[model samples]
Target: MASICLGRQPILDRNHNLVAFELLFRQEETEETAHVTSDLSASANVIVNAYGKFGIHNVLGHQRGFINADPDLILSDIISLLPSKHIVLEVKESASITLEFLQRCKELKQKGYQFALDNIVAINSQVELLLPLVSVVKIDVLALTRNQLTQLVNQLNHWPVLLLALKVENQEQEAHCRQLGFQMFQGYYFAKPEVMSIKRADPGKIPLLKLLALVMQDNDQNSDIDEIEKEFKHQPGLSYNLLRMVNSGSDGLPLKINSIKQAVQLMGRKQLQKWIQLLLYTSSQSADSLSDEITQTAVTRGKLMELIARAERPHDKNHHERAYMVGILSLLDQLLGIEMQQIVNKLGISDDMNQALLNRQGRLGQALKLIEAKEKGETASIPSLLSELDFLSLNELSDIETQVRGWTDHTDATVN
Candidate 1:
């Protein structure tokens, strides 16, 4: 019953936001035969060669995706799997971008495919030669020195290639890279994906459970709106959580609800009860007794972030799931005060999401790290994270931050 999750990745729009997203995805490939440690790769050739629609519809369609492949894999399957007009093909650094590969890439470009050079650098002669063919260039910033970096920055400014500063270790590096003009970034400084364990009675779920209990204890299928408000007010955070959830969506409600009573009226009692119970069981809070505020905060953050991710990536991709996973994971310790891996074990999250959560060695992990950094008020690292997610406009980024903060404030006030 493993479920694919967003992990701790940051979900960005054309602007970067602390969005809720399905940053990671997976198949129940645990045949015990599907090695737990296989070298991951992109199979673009499967797309081109395949007659029908690319299978990327369900698999590898997470908010942030990573695929690694050697020359042979790309030369053979990658060309086919590449949907050209959509999706990205990241050529592994292990491959030599010989003229032949470049020629093939050129042909693909003519057909509308986009390409990225993974872990690129100065000595990566093949990438340098094919710079014109690439849409994005990811550099392992950890390995580059100030001087080497200077050369790349100076040389790339004139190119159309988007520079991704990968493995940016800290806020200082993020700042320096922004000053040097890198487009996106990745690193450990962003929130590290953590695996936590939680129990049903854990304090994390107290608020949610309390709300649930109160609602259930007064089992009137049609409780008065004021009574419902009283229930939420009894707990410190419930009203705010409702406001945050409603406001998070694209069809922003016309009137802002400042209290739980209004929210109860807005959503009939039946709907409110169902959602509250659902929120209680969601990954946001442990399956324990709940507080009004913590429970509502988890729900508010998860729903709000998900709305942001879904809006930015309107396609059928699982961006919402990614966004929610990160939002919940970010607040897990605060709500539960438990170790992370334990949480993963208790939940039904799939292996790939676990990789992003536990290892932070992949693409989704990097994105999550970025979101964590921004949320912590580290503005300098914003650029690098955006680069990792892709090119982002400052205005969109601002909107996202504003939305999250607004939701946070709204949720707090309503709940308090």
Candidate 2:
């Protein structure tokens, strides 16, 4: 149940009211620059994860969703899975503008599914063929020069399609698009992605490494407390943060927590382990990347996998814990810039954990893969993956993802 990192950009009307969100998508093996894929299944997966997995309302709230739809999806019955009332099917520019495509749009239009032309830069015969069928034309404002923008606007003036200016990065662009009669606006001009560079893992992680080892080796003995307390004493910063977080409004303790020992006693082994796993991400030096976003992703992934395991093995609490470990640890290589085996050995985790992390073997490993596939939008493997896990369906996966995301958001809000 690693959380699918669903990206969304708001689409605003001329009056700057939020009308809808364009759900950004990426699949496994795709380029970083590619937001939405041309693959029909990729689009379907996005829909499934968004409306199905993440809960359409959780991601979209009261507004609508504008999703990318390639030619195949536009013509196929799969697009029907998305309720027409909540989504505007955006046709990718590469889709051949043909009589059949138009016919399909026309048919869907009859059924109340709206359509838009995505990332249009110019007007031509093909564009003309589609202009009547689509309700909106998304123009990349950054892609068009001043003269071209004016010309394109004038060319489309008589057409019925509403113009949406995309990639609006400043007030000037916003004003220009407005003056040019663009009916909608989108881009970083509204909100920017907080940029962060991956830094080398902090040396501080060594203490966490010790704590992880101690927690992993717990034999339900009093000795576990001494070993863990010793590790905490060595890392004053970690102890302070842990105590502060546990007492802070986020943990919502009925009694104020004042000591590491108290926090450990109250949090217990399982809760404390998850807390430490989260600490591994924050222990990094970077203020933004590892501290906030990366840690959130790992936490979400871990929780999702844990939920999936619980669904599959209701009584096996140990399996659920292991699944969470596999998820958060899966990102160890990227976080630590070290080999998975090296990190696994250093942490003294079980062989099963090692196999799941390094080789993607066993039930926990499969759970990890299922989460990864969801994140990557690899729909092809989703059915087979679900079948192996007691026939969990796409809708079930969506619920799991949505629940984990909500939990992660709540935890992050508490910690922050």
Candidate 3:
């Protein structure tokens, strides 16, 4: 199955506790357009993949799922498939709130479904019709001025619906919304992206590179446990993070792993490789150059490309792993502030991955293109880009995103 990238933006209640997650699906392509041929399919794909591949709890944890629904998706039996108690069906602003559509919503409401109005900009007749049916109204806090925000809140006061502020960018905006009596908030304000400068790789990175090389070695016969231990000893910080992660109860080890040797033996080469790769991505210490956001993007790209490679060539484990390497290393130039060729030469990665990183020529390179497109929110261009590879679909791509997000979150929790 092709792995898709699923992103969840947290929605918080008045007390700042996570109450729900808006399920977002991103497909990678090279184009920069937002026009998709089928909003219904996109919506349905998100619901299907969120419920099917990743499972609701994996994506949303214990919080409710806020899914956007088009008019067609609203009418379909797919809405009935979702657990009513765990989801709040969001009415898309573009959805024509005709009498028939409202009737269907009412039917679902009678069946114990909840609704939210997305992108509320005005108090129009259609919005007025949906106001009573929806339990929450999501207003774009960034798009509206203070006066407009106040006017919208004042207009909605007649209804018992809760106000949910979207696109809140900072504490100031969040506080402003709270002052305006908005009961819920959503945005990237909490963990803002850090600006990383172009600097030479740190001295500590040398040991990490050595450990990475040892772990990524193709041979199984050579017992390099002692050498690996030496590398960890050389870098105490990496060792500490490694031990902290192993003992964090995230690995589910029967006994506490106190030493690097114990970890290496128990984790094996493949698992160890994965763990080290994750560590390289998440390390925020002075030695690690990449910011959390950049690392997250790289990790997500690696996972999505790996899933795509798996779908294309199911029997080729090497290709799958290499595809993942391509994804993670695709952004190495930006992360390390080094030339792509120089970076690849230092890492000793495969020619295919090297070519993909530098020129985007091979299959892995094409996969990277899609990942870039998804990162750029170019969903409409993905289909055309992948026209040669018919096995991949937009929904499947989206599903992979969800899976990766869960994996990233789980890894972060474990490492932290």
Candidate 4:
């Protein structure tokens, strides 16, 4: 998944716990514009312009969105183009702290638009001029240690400007930042970031991929099962796994599955491929011979949320697919040594699915993160997050383990 300007961890008090995150959003691609004007005046398009639609839409309903802008945009009439009060105008680091930029910032602040100074460091820079003008001063965490951060916090401690620590990477860093009195946190340490190179292959996949390639061929919209498996006469192991999955009681098949034909006839295309993928994980690579239970946790969570959406709202969605994708991909960064998008494209996922995983752009991404937080047992913040999602509690979400446990069990059982 590509990192769209997705969501971020909220700025925390020195406690290293979440207070509320800086929510990132994707600019919806709509041809016709409403709140923003056709004329691009001051801000030369150095940064990708997010359509103020997310802000406007939030405005109509009273929500908040943060939009980053340059000094040029501040000087132009563009600040007026913002939809409503629910926006935080982030003054980019590249922008000058000129009298004009400061004056416009003061004007926006007067109009209820919060200003954030991006990548601020060393209170002495032009930041000294703009500090009194902005509400939040965001510092990149990578550049500071506990000592330097402590010094900065002590210095900025008296100022009303909030100290936001952005891009925190691990528990130690998080804890250190908390000790240093940072008010916000953001980074990739929460979910496993996908790695580009997993040194070993799933030993089970070599054989399994070959079999799956067989099954995938029949999936051609035109071909029948018998016609597809017609050429493979010597595949016994493939014959057995399909039979086990078909007879695995979950399918409720009337008779036992002995051949690929029986599996094709009874289980159908969709279910069979799922079993094959799960079984393949039985090999040593990702599963580490562990059960699919770990991955299933994510899948079940995704599916349950999807079900909640469907019953509550009524929509035809690949909620289950999205769920499985999240569960499996949570470990992707480990296997691939890269970001989620690198592997997400290898799978069949929808735009919303991609949005949630890579960019944290959709409803599902919010749901997934909520589940993750709950699982970690961050007692106080989860409910507040739930409040944002407009959901009651973990009562419904608690059912996720039931959905995903079996997959984990399959791989675990094999290892044992």
| Per-candidate count of clashing residue pairs (backbone under 3 Å) | 57, 4, 13, 22
Best by lDDT: 2
Q: Write the per-residue lDDT of candidate 1 for residues 1-416, one digit (tens) a residue.
A: 22222222332222344322112222222211121121221122122111111123222333333344334334332244333433456675433345555666687777777667777667456556667877877777888888888788787777888877777778777777777877666556654332111111221355554454445343464564555567567654445446543432213123566666666666554445555544444433223333435543544455445645665576735656666655555456555666667655544355544665677534456555655565467889878776776734556666655544422223223310
Stretches off by above 4 angstroms in model 3 are 28-35, 191-416
Model 2 lDDT on a 0 to 1 scale: 0.68
Off by over 4 Å in 2: 27-38, 193-416
Instruction: Give a tens-digit lDDT track for model 4, residues 46-77.
Output: 11112211112222123344555655345433
CA lDDT scores, all candidates in order: 0.49, 0.68, 0.67, 0.50
State which candidate, 2 or 3, has the greater lDDT. 2
What TM-score do all the candidates reach, one by one?
Answer: 0.36, 0.45, 0.45, 0.37
CA displacement after TM-score superposition, residue 163 of candidate 4 (Å):
1.4
Q: Give the residue spans of candidate 1 off by over 4 A.
A: 1-15, 18-66, 93-96, 191-416
TM-score, cand. 3: 0.45
Give candidate 3's whole-model lDDT: 0.67
| Candidate 2 C-alpha error for residue 158, in Å | 0.4
